[model samples]
Target: MLYAILAYHVEEEVASWTPEEDATVMRDLNKVHGRLNELGRLGPAARLGATEGACVLRGPRKGVVTDGPFTESKEQLLGFYILDCADRDAAISAARDLRQVNPSAMYEIRPVKLYLPGVPFPRTEDGVDA
Candidate 1:
């Protein structure tokens, strides 16, 4: 089965990190990613931008567009990882590996019912995972 590992953290806390601190976390996470990739269990990963530049469309048809990441939770979703695992336990294990490096963050793992990955889009930059 395929699972989505959602990464969440307090925006202020993450935004407070130095460049080096952020890089360290990414490096360690990439190590786990490498192992999973080697096992052919990893899929497309993403790092979302801050809510400051985000918008939300609510209600009917061409709904009203609003600002910010408006979840009721304190922690905002900052990133995600897609993994192919044998079972729920395996999916949780993958999230655990991610949490080991970034202990302060939280993860929510959910099974993927369907994945429709479309044709590749043009690359703008050699940016981070997303």
Candidate 2:
């Protein structure tokens, strides 16, 4: 199964880190990433730009666009990783490893629902998995 691990951290806290501290954190995280890559579990990953440059688009009919990272919380989405895991437990284990490296942030693991070409849409009736 494919899982998306979303990394969230306080923008101020991350931006305030010293250069050495940032490098050390990244080094530790990269160690974990290297292992995952060797195991063929790592997929697409990226570090997002600062939230200040972000824009939100809403209202499909009106196509209204607004500038902001998100309206809900202070913590900004820092990064994400697409991991191929055997199951939910494996994905959680992978997230745990990341949490160890960066203890100040939160990671959200979600299964990816891929829309493949020529595939029938997943049934949404009767509270079934979709």
Best model per TM-score: 1
Residue-wise lDDT of candidate 2 within 16-128, one digit each (tens)? 99989988988999899999999999987767777887998887797889997665777889899999999999999999999999999999999999923365555342225
Residue runs of model 1 more than 4 Å from their true location after superposition = 121-130
Model 2, TM vs. native: 0.85
lDDT, candidate 1, residue 49? 80
For model 1, residues 1-130, the per-residue Cα lDDT tens digits are 9999999999899889998998899899889999999999998887778879898888898899889769999999998988999999999999999999999999999999998778765533225443
What value does the lDDT take at residue 104 in candidate 1? 97
Worst-scoring 10-residue span by lDDT in model 1: 121-130
Model 2 bad stretches (over 4 Å): 115-130
TM-score of 1: 0.91
